[model samples]
Target: MNETRREYIKRINIVLDFIENNLDTKLSLEYLSKKAHYSAYHFHRVFLTLVNESLNEYVNRKRIERIAAILLVKPNSSLKNLAYKYGFNSDNSFSRAFKKYYGISPTKFKSEGKELLSKIGIEPFSSEKYICSIDNIKQWTKMNAQITIKELPELKLASISNIGNFEKAGSMFQKLMEWGHQKRVLDTSNFKAITIYRDNPNITQTSKVRFSACVTISENINTDGEINQHNLKKGIYSIGHFEIKAEEISKAWKSMSIWVIENGYEFRDGDYFEMYHNDHKTHPEQKFIIDICIPLQKTENIKLGEINNLDLSKYKDNLDYHQLISYMKELRLFFQKEYDTIFKLGKIYQGAPNFSYFSLTTDELKKQKLKFVIILNHKELYFSICLSGQNKSIRKKYWKIFKGSDWNKYHLAESIDNSLSIIDQTILKNPDFNNKRNLTERIEKESLKFINDIKNILE
Candidate 1:
C-alpha cells in the first residue's frame, strides 16, 4: 500500500482531520508527519501534490477561516483572545492577516460578515436562508429523525469514489456488491451500505463535493481500479436515524447540522456519512431508512492514547505467516497419513494471510454433507478444529439444528453466510512450539477428541 495514490489520500485525510480538530494547538510538521507515519520530506511532497498547496499555507488559511467563521456568529468576541487562541502572536498580526485574506479589517467584517462572505460565495455554516426558522427546523427534525450521540467502532470499507454527482450511488453500490460477492468478502450477516461525504458540503462547491459509495466488508482487500480500501477510524459521532424521501434528504442534512449547533456540540473532522438501512423503492411511501452520522469532538472522559495501550499483537505468535503455513501443511500431511481410510483429507488452504486450514471428512459425514476442518490462526497464535459443511446451505441447515438443540460441546459460529464452520473448538491457545513433537502430539490428541465426538452426534 505504500506510495500508492489512495494511500497518500488516506494519509493526507488524517492530517487534514487533525488540523481541523486541533486548530488551537501547536501543529508542527514533525508531529503531523509522525501522525501520518511518513517522513517529513515525503509527507510534504505528497501533501503538496494532493492538496495543491504547501502545508504551512493550508494551515494558515484554515486558521484564518475559522476565526472569521466564529466572528460571524459572535461579533463582539475579543479579537485579542481569539487571535491568541488561533496561534497569532498579537492582535496586530491577526488583523493584518485577516485583512489580507478578506480584503477588509476584522472589525468591518464582523459588522458585515454575512454580506462579505456571500460576496465570495461562501455561506456561513448556519445561514438563516438555508432554514425557515429555528423552531420549525427543530420540529421538522423531531418528526423525521431520532438523534443520539454515540461512539462508533472502526469500520472496514470497500468503497468507490464518486466526485460531484451523488445520484450515481445506485450504480456504484451495485458495482460494489458485485465486487464484494466476487471476492467473497461481503459481511452478509451485518453488512452496511454507507455513503461518506469526503468533502464538507457546506464549504465545497456542489459540483466538486466528493462522496464514496461504500459497503462493510468481512476482511482487508487490495485496492482495485476505482474501488479503494480504508478504515473509518473509531470516534464519537452524532447519529440521526431518519426515514425520508429522496428530495427531503438535503433538508435532513441541514436540520442535523442545526441540531448539532443548537445542542452545543462541536463538529469534529472525521467523516460525515449516511448508513442506509432499507431501499426506498421497497417502501410504500418510497422513503429511505437511513442513519446520518456527524463526527463530534471527543468528550473529556475519552483520554488520549487510550486505544494505543491495548495491543493484541502481544498475544500472537512470533512465527511468520509463511512459517505458520508450513506448519499447517505438515499437520495436514500428518492427518492424511494417519487417518488413511477413516477420513478423507483436503489440501491446506490459505485464503487470507491471517489464517489457513484443511478439511477432513469420513464417508458417513460426507453423506450428511459435512466436513471437519483443522485451522491455524497465525494472527491470534491459536489452533482450532471445526465441523463445517460442503457449502453454505448445508452449513446453515446444520447450524440451525445445533442452535436449537443443547449441543454445548463446542463453540458454534454465529453465522454461516461468511463462515464455513458451524461448530468449532480451539485445540491449542498460545501454543508452545519450543517442543515441536509435544505440540504435534497435543494437536493430534485434541483433534481426535473433536472428530470422535462430532462423529457420534451425526454418524
Candidate 2:
C-alpha cells in the first residue's frame, strides 16, 4: 500500500472507533478531525478521498444503519425512542435519512422489517441471520487484507448473454448450463465457470443490465457464430474471494471496492468477473466459494519503484516443476533464447509473506531424460523428457508417486517464458524508465530493467 493509503486507513479506523463508541453523541467535523489526527480544514477532503463519501453523509448513513438493526431484534421498539437513541432530535430527521439511504421510511421499514433487517453492512443477511459482535470485527478486518488488486488481460469467451438484474442471474446461469450440456462444450472435469457483468450495478437500471454466464474453453473450440463471443479488455483489477451465499455477494463487492479506494487505487470502468468455484448447485450455501475481480486504474501520481520490491529469492526454494517451466518460458520470450531440452521435478507451495514452495525429485540424473516438479497451492507441475528407454524408466520411477494425488492441472509449458517477458516489457515501456530525475523515477527505471532481465533469462 502507498503512504497516502496508509494514512487513510489509520484515519478511517480512528473514525470507526469513535463512531462505535459515541453513536449517541453529535459527531462534528472538527471533533472527528481531532480523533483522526488531521486538521479540521483538511479532514473533509481527506475523508472523502478515502471513503468516497462526505463525512456528514457517512455519519448519517451509519446512524440510520444502526437504527435499522435495533428495530429488527426489538420489533416492539418505538421509532421515536430509536431516533433519540441514535442522536436524532426528532423522528422526522431520522426517517428522512433512513429513506434516503434505504429507500424506505423508518415506520415503513419496521412494518416490512424483514428485508431491511436482512441487509446490513453492505451485505444481505439470509434466513439464518446472526448479529456479529464487535469482538469479531478484528477478524473480519484481518481477512480484508487478503484481498488483492490485479491486472488481467482481455479474455476471449463463449457465453450465453442475458440482459436483466441480479435477481435473474440464477435463471441465466441455469440456461447456460443446459446449453453447455447439450452442446458438449463445458468440461465438467475443468469446471471454472464465470459470470461477466457489462454494466455497473451502482449506475445501471435493473431491467437493462447485461450479464453473461461463461465458461473458459480451449482456443481450438470452433465457434459457429451461434454462441456470443466477447473480448474482455486487458486492464488493472481489484480482486477478492469470499465463501458466502449468493445473496450476500454484493456485500463482498462493496467491501472490496471500499478497501481498494481506501488504499489509493482508482476503480476502472470495465466488466467485473465473478468466478464461481462452488455454489448451491454443487455445494451447501455456507460453503459456496466465489472469486470477484474488479478492474482498477491507479489515479495518484505514484511510481512502481516507490512500492516495496518483491523478494524473488524467497520463491527459489518453493519453485514447482511447472513454475520452473513458466520461468523458462519467460526467459525465452524476453531473451529470445531456447534450451535444447529441459527436465524438472519438485513440489512447490505458497508461503507466508509471499514466499512459495518447491521440492525437487530424487532420481538418478541422466543427460537425455530430465525430471522436475513445481508445486503451487494444491497444484503441481511435473515434466520429464528422455532420449532413451532407460532414461525414461528413471523418470517414471520418480513420477509414479506424484501422479495420483489431487492437484490443479494446467498446461504451463507452452508460453511460460513469454508471459514474464511481457511484464518486463510493460514496465520498461513506461516513460519514466529512462529519466533518472528523482527517486521514484530512478526506482521505476531500475525495477523495469530488473524485471526485463529476469524475463530474458527465463526463456
Candidate 3:
C-alpha cells in the first residue's frame, strides 16, 4: 500500500474504534474530534471527506443498523426499550429517525421480522467480506465479459402506459407487441424497444410502474401520429449480448448493477431501454437475446485498481528471474534520483521470524541515495520500496517504475519475485549492517528450500 492509502485506512480504524467505545454514550462532535486527534471544527469536515458521510449521519445510521439487526433476532423485543438501549431518549424521536433512514416504522419492522439488515443499508459483519480476495475481480470480470460499443440513432414507437411496478412492465411490453402483431400494425423490422423505469425501486410503488413499449421505424414508413419519436441520443455504450432464460432476468439485472459500480460509472437516471433482438417466437425454446445498455460518465475521485489479465501459460518456461530482478533495481534507483521524499527499503522473508524482517522508516528511506530490499521465502520472493510524499513529482517517479519492461506480461507472482531479489541484494551489500552477507545467504537458501517445498506439494 502507498502512504496516502495507508494513512486513510489508519484514520478510518481510529474513527471506528471511537464509535465502538462510545456507542451507548451521546457521541458529540467535540468528543469525536478529541478521539480522532483533530480540531472539533475540522473533524466533521475531514471525517466526511474521508468516509463520504457526515458525523451525525454515520452515527445515527449505525445505531439504526444495530437496532434492525437486534429486531431480526429478537422479534418480540419492545421497540421502546430498544430505542433507549441505543441512546435514543424518546420512542417518537427514535421512530422518526428509523423510518427516515430505513423507510419503515420500528414497530412494523419488529412485527414483520423480515430481514431488515440489507433494507437499512447495514453491512453484515463477516471476515470473508474484508478478505479482499483477487478472486472477486476475476468473478466480476467474467460475469461482465467485455462488451462491444454500438451507436444507435433516434427511434419512433408506440406502447401502453402503466402507473407503477416496473418489473411487470416487461410483460406488458410483450403483450403490447403481441397485440400489435395480431392487428398487423407492428412491423417486425421496426426493432422492438422498451422504455423502462428511471426511479428508485426501494421507494417506487407497484401501482406506478412507468414504462413505454416502443419501436424504431423508417421515416418513409409513416404511421398516423400514434407513434412517439424517441430521439435516442448518440453516445458510447457498452453492449452485452446475453440470452436470458425466463427465470434468470433478475440475476442479469443485479450483475449489470454491480458492473456499473465497480467500473466507477453512475447509472444515468433515464430510461434503460433494452432491445429484444430475438425471442422464443422465432425459436420454440423462447431463449430471449437481450442487448443491455448502461450509460456511463467519467467522474473525478473514482479509480479502478489494476486488473490481472495475464496469460500465464504463454511465458511459463521463458521467464528470466535474474534479469527481471536487475531491471527492478534499476527502476528503484531511478525513483530515488527523481523524488525528494522518504523512501523505505524493506525485505520480508517467507517462513522466517517476524522480527527478522526490517523496514526503513519513511525518513531514513528517503535519505538514502539509492536503496532496495528483497525477501526470500521457500518458493517466493517479495520486494517493496517507498517513494515518499504526495507531490506530482513523486507520482511521476513511481509511474515510471513499471515502464519499458515486460512487467505488464508477468503475473503478480513474477513481479514479487523480481522485487524480492533486488531488496535482498541491497540489504546484503549494506556496509553498515555487520552480518549482511550471512543474512542474505540464509535468505537465499531458505527461499530455494521454500520453492522445493511448493514443488513437492504441487507434484
Highest TM-score: which candidate? 1
lDDT of 1 by residue, 1-459 (tens): 344876777677667757867889998889999988999999999888877778887777778877875675467888889889999888888889888877888889888766776667665555566466788887777656667677888999998775577779899899999999999998888799999986665544466566789999989987675677868889988777776789778788888888877877777767899999888887535778888888888766433322211123544455555567788887888878888989899767653445679999888888988999999876678899999987778999999999999879899898888786899999999887677778889999999999899888874
Q: What is the C-alpha lDDT of each candidate?
A: 0.78, 0.51, 0.47
296-402: candidate 2 lDDT, tens digit per residue: 66655433322111233443345433344444333223322222232232323221112233322223333423323221221222222111112334434433422
Better of 1 and 2 by TM-score: 1
Q: Model 2 misses residue 259 by how many Å? A: 0.7
Span of 10 residues, lowest total lDDT, candidate 2: 418-427
List, residue by residue over 1-459, the lDDT tens digit for candidate 3. 476544544554456545744667788888788876778887787777755678888788767766775565456878888789888989889989998976779888776534453344432221133324335533643433334344455454554433354565567576656656655655567566655443223222234223455654444232222223344555444454455565545444445545655555554423466667664466323656676666544355334322112222333233233323433344335435543264444422111111113233345334432223333211122322222222334334433453434444222222332132211221222111234445444444543343333223223
Q: Each prediction's TM-score against the native?
A: 0.49, 0.36, 0.34
Query: If the candidates were sorted by their TM-score against the true structure, best first, what order would they fall in?
Result: 1, 2, 3
Query: Scored by Cα lDDT, where does model 1 land?
Result: 0.78
Question: What is the lDDT for 171 in model 1?
Answer: 95
User: Model 2 has how many clashing residue pairs?
Assistant: 27
